[model samples]
Target: MIRFENIDLAYQGNNVFSDFSLEIAQGEKVVLLGKSGLGKSSLFSLILGFVQPQNGKVFFNENRVDERIVWNVRQKVAFIDQEISIGDYSVSEWLTFVSGIKANHSLSFGGKRLKELMDFFELSRDILNKDISDLSGGEKQRVAIIVSVLLERDVFLLDEVTSALDENLKKKTAEFFVERKDWTVVSISHDPVWLKNPWVKVFDLEKKTWK
Candidate 1:
């Protein structure tokens, strides 16, 4: 379970969101929707503990979201963003490094498991040896998605993850999300395919007053 209680946040005195509240039960798939600047991504960042609200609180599994347990929460959640990890290695090396992270390492997905995931995501075997810079936006997005899926985290925080994908790829990823029997999904998306999905619990940010 997760809760955002009357949260208020701002940047330089400008309101990001105010008096915002929502709850997500385990295994539920939710969508946060509104105009672009209404702090949809900030909501995602808050849940991931990357950003703190100026007031109010965020809770994960009924515990307050704080530094002490943020890492623990992160270990159980996979976040996929459009721009992530433009790095100094080949595509394969990126996977190797991330899988070695403490969170992923504990998941026990070694090279063989990683290869299986890459195959499932439809990544070209050649990408494994290619420089990260050589990958197109779509390829990088797929790689990032594979990384998250391999983590085996039941919860996903996705932000326009399909922005660079074609219709086929979008549906493929959607299928992946749907098949996860225990997934708790919260995504910030404008893609028509995702926005209208009934599996999502919808929240609209436009009705509230900015702080």
Candidate 2:
């Protein structure tokens, strides 16, 4: 659950959000649709404490998010960025590093589950040994998603996550998240596959309307 109340935000003399407000209930699936520069991704930044609103508040699960609890909020939410940038580490090394983080220490990355997810995402297990920098864009995206899944976070912030996937893979990815009844998902995407899901509500950032 996330809520933004009357937010006003700007950067370098340019306004991004003005008196913007939104509330996402638990287990809700929302897709933010709009042209670029509409502050779609900035919403996630506010939720994650990457940026703070000059005028309003951001709340997560009934608790106001601030510096004191930002880490906790991040631990509970999985954010998969459009550009997967985890340096030059190998896939396996990246997985190990993510699982090794203090916030993720309690969540075990089971080899069996990892392989299963990789297979479901149409990725080869052998790719684990490949350098992350060498993987194709689609491969990188799937790998980022798999890592998020392995973390078992109930809330997801997906930013153009299927941007590089093929048509089939895009559908597969959309269906996989749409079927999760207990997960809260807020995504930014232009992919029609996501919008086709009846369970997903589309929020037009530019118009400040929902469809």
- Top candidate on TM-score is 2
The superposed Cα distance between candidate 2 and the true structure at residue 78, in angstroms, equals 0.2
Q: What's model 1's lDDT at 62?
A: 88
Quick one: best lDDT, which candidate? 2
Local distance difference test, each candidate: 0.80, 0.93
Q: What stretches of model 2 exceed 4 Å from their correct place?
A: none
The local lDDT score (0 to 100) that residue 10 gets in candidate 1 is 94
Q: TM-score for each prediction?
A: 0.91, 0.98
